[model samples]
Target: MATSKSKTSLREDLTCAICFELFKEPVMLGCMHHFCRRCIVSYWKSVRSPVTCPQCRQEFPNKCCFQTNYLVANLVEKVRASSSPASVKYLEKELNDCLESQCSMKDAYISMIRKDKDKMEKIKKTGAELQGRVHNDFQALHHFLQVEEEAMIEELKREQEEMLQGLERHLEALQVAIRDVEKNINILRQTAGSTDQSVLVELPKLNSRPISIDI
Candidate 1:
């Protein structure tokens, strides 16, 4: 393979830069640049002196500065003879194989990119769904807490009202008992100087009456 590539490179080197073809009647300029003899002559006729090499642009004194390069001419002839129909077919097959491999690689890269894009879309969709579910879950939790709070507060209020009512009833009973005690003390003050036997009987009746209070 390396030998074949070297021969191909050598053949390319023997091609004329001006005509882009295998060198015919190859000639070398003073600058060592090569071209076909007729190609350089025609190129020089189109330009003014001092003439310049087509490839390097190196100036020459005159067209006479160019001379036939017999060695390059012989190399070009040998390269032409070596390029048989079979070799041309082999080169074509190699080019087609390279093109097919490049196309397959391109397809593989495109498939990978497509798969990655799909995965990205899936990730985004799943994330959005999860976020929605989280939001809904939190909202439900908040609602439950709110309901529990309201219920607890309402229960506390009812219990407090019941306790206050019980206390008020107890206070009213204590007030009535105090009024009865004051009435008995007034009676005792009025009857004390007389020293009546009937007052002693009334004292027993007053003692028998009871004031009942419930917590």
Candidate 2:
């Protein structure tokens, strides 16, 4: 295994500052800023006179002032080859971990779906029970209203019949009084026409009785 510091150092040495790639046909300048041979040649060709390093800008005599860094090139190739095996092993482990995570999530999703289904069933059952209770309550209320209405109607009828009976008794008493008055008028007319003196002197007696209402 490589320590983090060593890995960082190796990565810095293996990479080229000019093209920012892994060194290809590497070369070194007097400034010690390593670059690819072709990259440095192309960069220096852009400027006239003494060429400067792309990294530190240390002036060189001209474009033809660099030497191949053979030791760095050999080290880069070895490090790249060795890190390849480690990269392959890490990728394999990562793939296996991703597969396990996916399976666990799938199971969780299934369990959540089942729980939601149960809750929905319970809710539906409760809704049905509530509906029945509402209907029953309204049915009882309607029955109570109907019974009260009938009882009230019966009471009204009884009161109306009693009032009618009292009125009939009053009418009968008035008829009897009217008849007696007419009879008395006939007797007075006969007395004025010189009927028997004794009969005229003895006037008819009148009797009246008030009707009674039982309420």
Candidate 3:
């Protein structure tokens, strides 16, 4: 294969400065500048007075003072022949295939990125919903537990109050019983001093009274 530099140099050598294409009928000016015959003629006709080389800007005395370069023309013909229609069509097809493949790859990458972003969003949404449900459940549980604790404490207080009232009533009853016993003791002391037969009769009645206390 020819190097890129050599190919570029060869193309530049065969190309006309005016039309910037491969020379149709190559011509040389007095300034040693090359152009297509029609291109140079048209350039001179469009300009005023003396003709100038398009590349070097060199002036020529005669307007039609350009010679047909047979060697350059032959080279141009050979270059044109070498780059046939079949070769040009093959190169075009290759370029089109490469561009199509690159576009398809780019589209595939874009699709993958879009799908991943959608999946990530779905994951975040689901996670947030689950968190909300958990928080609500914990709040409900806390409320229920608080209610249960308060009810239990109230029940304990009620039971404690009832027990304390019962104890107080029992103490009052015991105090009344103690006072009655003391009154009986004083009556016996007086009766023992007197040698009365009536007091001895009442002693039997006092012995008949029940002594066992019921709670």
Maximum-lDDT candidate:
1
Q: Per-residue error at 60 for model 3, in Å?
A: 35
For residues 1-215, write the lDDT of model 1, one tens digit per residue.
79789997998899999999999999999889999999999999998777899899999877889889999999998889769787778878998999999999999999999999999999999999999999999999999999999999999999999999988888887887888888778767766756566646554334224656566
* Displacement of the residue 59 alpha carbon in candidate 2, Å: 40
Model 3: per-residue lDDT, tens digit, 20-130? 899988988888888898998998889897668888888889877889999999998877775779767886798799999999999999999999999999999999999
When sorted by TM-score, best at the front, the candidate numbers are 1, 2, 3
RMSD of each: 8.7, 9.6, 9.3
Lowest-lDDT window of 10 residues in candidate 2?
A: 206-215
Q: Model 2, range 105-211, lDDT digits (tens) per residue? A: 99999999999999999999999999999999999999999999999999999999989997787878778867877777776676668756765656556444554
Query: Candidate 1, 134: how far from true, in Å?
Result: 3.0
- The CA-based lDDT of model 2 is what? 0.83
lDDT (Cα atoms) of all candidates against the true structure: 0.88, 0.83, 0.83
